[model samples]
Target: MTHIRPTAAPATRLALAGAVALLAAACTSTDSGGAKGTSTEAKGAVPAVSAPPSIATAADKALPIDPYLLSYEQRDQLERADSVLVTRCMARFGIQYQAPPQIPGGNRPRSRTDRRYLEMTADSAQAYGYHGAEGDRPTPAPPPPQVSDATRLVLTGSAAANAKSGQGGQDYNGAKVPKGGCLGEAKEKLGANPSNNGGGDAQLARDIDAGARERSKTDDRVLGVFKSWSDCMRTKGYDYPDPVKVLDDPRWSSPAPTDVERGTAVADVACKQQANVVGVWFAVEAAYESQLIEQNTTALAQIRKENEDRLRAAAQALSS
Candidate 1:
């Protein structure tokens, strides 16, 4: 999934952080398409639940697209701007700050989406089975140079002081730490508010996500592919209702997948390939998103304008 760092806005920074984490989770395959599981039938038929198309349609109309839900290039520019700001902030205190090295490839979605719902590639399934690469991914870059207590007090204001004082610290060096400290200042300098278009964007994301999952539950195209996958799993002695059930199986909850889990995962991928589950689901989701985007052209255009403005501000901030 795309990783947009949260802004340090006083009212919504924490909420945005939580939302980003949730968005990450949403784009991953960890939650069985982000739907709760139901008991499987002995015959492997999934129960159907009808969804309203209006859910997707309404969500798109109600909220503006977030300017910060940026593409990889935009995110890179923002990160650079952030690094520059951090370096300047630290320099003010006579501290040299070396920005953390960027991850070699940087973070970009491998596909149109994060492939969370449909992540099992033929090779991935054969090699690692159902286990995700979360454990195997590269460690994060080391942090920048550590700051001294005095400098921390200057940057963070009272929060750091209160942590040391056993009292609420709201000010630093006799001044309140801006909402998120120096980091917040950096974000503000770039003209980015981490809040979701004043919270509307966040709600829109939730609505769209929920709508997509609901569609997955009942979409005829998805169900047809799922039936084929279920039949294939049954041949392998697994009686799963759908791909979601395959991951949601309690037996796969161990630190490492049980042998059965691994085997089942391999079989699951084979069946998904045979049934073309990923292709069908991807097309369906793209269609839904296209409709949403089409319905919100004005709002999305406004968001684009805002993003352009912020990028311009970031450029000025860096040059200055």
Candidate 2:
């Protein structure tokens, strides 16, 4: 349950090339139903999607306890540990490395169960249209404190080193940069390397996410709701086949939403509400995730244990 402190600039952001692109396409709206000051709870009989006892029970089960999904807290702790190691190593080279300041009040954290489309509430739709309120959110801490040229040389290793066949590619003070550079050394010390599939945890996390997205696209229940939503949009003169398609519309690319985009977004939310898209989609995905979790219990347990050990080491590094 250790919270991983986020870095001023997360290197993981760079590592997750494709996954980050996928996330961008799946961007959630700021106005989750609760945040919009509106209620989505049904006052009477639940829709077929919410009425099934098995689905209801599954939905109630705590989500994202699976092996692959690292809780925000765990991710933050791991990042903090990495930063601590990096700072310590830099200091040995006489480089003053200041860790980035934490956000005053952290931005709302996304849960593993939370879906991008589901976050669009009627209230949010009415207010911001399809343009997400990302600009309104608190900015992340500034990039890590500036380093002098000597420090940068040590941290990045030398391009000149690659060229030099001998002398071990000397860095400042003729020191050989450790294999993989300073960042690699920090990761080695922490026993955290997402790029290496032999570790399995990072690769598994990516697999689970990719699997869910794929399943969602083909899930009968989800597709059914999407059809209803699409039909509703047709009545309103919009031609999007699904929510994802609607998000991809070029009109939404502007810094601020255009009237057309806003109007379409509002209608989109209305259709989603009318069709109970979020409720149905969530239940179906929950079932899928539960099955995946059951199939990978042992692998997940090992990942969880490794995470714990990493955090403990990170704590020690920070304290020291």
Candidate 3:
């Protein structure tokens, strides 16, 4: 996502801060729906969710991550986090899993997790009165795999036949295929069935599932940051404060930007320059912190402790 620096007028600086505070607060609201449910009090009290350690320190040090070689526990932790996030998001947004609408990129059917996140996003849009006429939330999952059961069976049968005939797995056909057997044939079948080549059909599905898992984990982290930012910003005070008031501000766009874009923008404005440093820093920090708190149901302290312990163990291993 691309980050765009916000340009608010000098006169509206306080207004902007107030607006952000309102946003920070709404992010914390636990009520079922609209105006009555909205309150600033929810901002500081982060739900008791936890987060994994950051992939690397803020210093940009490369953490020792090998996609192909993650430890079982590490992978399990990621899967658990993914499941939790997908389930929560679907519930929050009220997304119907039976028939998810198509999204750009591809037509992958919505997964359970995708539906959940979409539901959450929909509710958020509705809460802000930005509901789409279609009334359907964005599909949280990637495009449904273009391949069908028929396609799979057909390909599998063909491959099996070819393997038996010695005609399968033979190189130099009109189509290009690597020289290998059953596993290789499986890869080829995936590629030919949907004509899906990118990650090699089944390979792609695994990759997407893995990606979803990783993203789920990050969502928790972002939520944790949100809670901390809300708490920190609450201390800064604003006149005529109301969490819903930000919704009234012209600049206050609900779903204020994609999380990543907002995070980058906040970091850019806060960490890169001294101009409007305090407010900018606060905004950026608040973006991450607000996300963490609002989305993360775990306690920040606990998340940090677990991550820190893991980091310590890794350091010990390196030393040993």
TM-score top scorer: 2
Per-model TM-score versus the true fold: 0.63, 0.67, 0.20
lDDT of 2 at 172: 54
lDDT of 1 by residue, 1-320 (tens): 11333222211112222323433333211111222221111112332223423220121221122232554466567677777886787566555665664452322233224443444555655555555444343334554456676665545443354442222234544544455555556666766544333212323343444444444445687789889989988998989888766654666546554667668767877787777776665555544544444544454455456667777876776678
TM-score order, best first, reads 2, 1, 3
Could you tell which candidate, 1 or 3, scores higher by TM-score?
1
How well does candidate 1 match the true structure in TM-score terms?
0.63
CA lDDT of every candidate = 0.50, 0.54, 0.29
| Clashing residue pairs found in predicted model 2 | 3-77, 4-73, 4-76, 4-77, 5-76, 5-77
Span of ten consecutive residues with least summed lDDT in model 2 = 33-42
RMSD, each candidate, Å? 11.2, 11.0, 19.3
Q: Candidate 3: worst 10 consecutive residues by lDDT?
A: 56-65
Q: What would the per-residue lDDT of candidate 3 be over residues 74-177, giving only the tens digit for each residue?
A: 43333333333323332332322222222222211132112111111223333332222222322244443343332222222234433421233332223332
List model 2 lDDT by residue over 40-75, tens digit each. 111232223345222211223344534455555566
Q: Rank the candidates by lDDT, best first.
A: 2, 1, 3
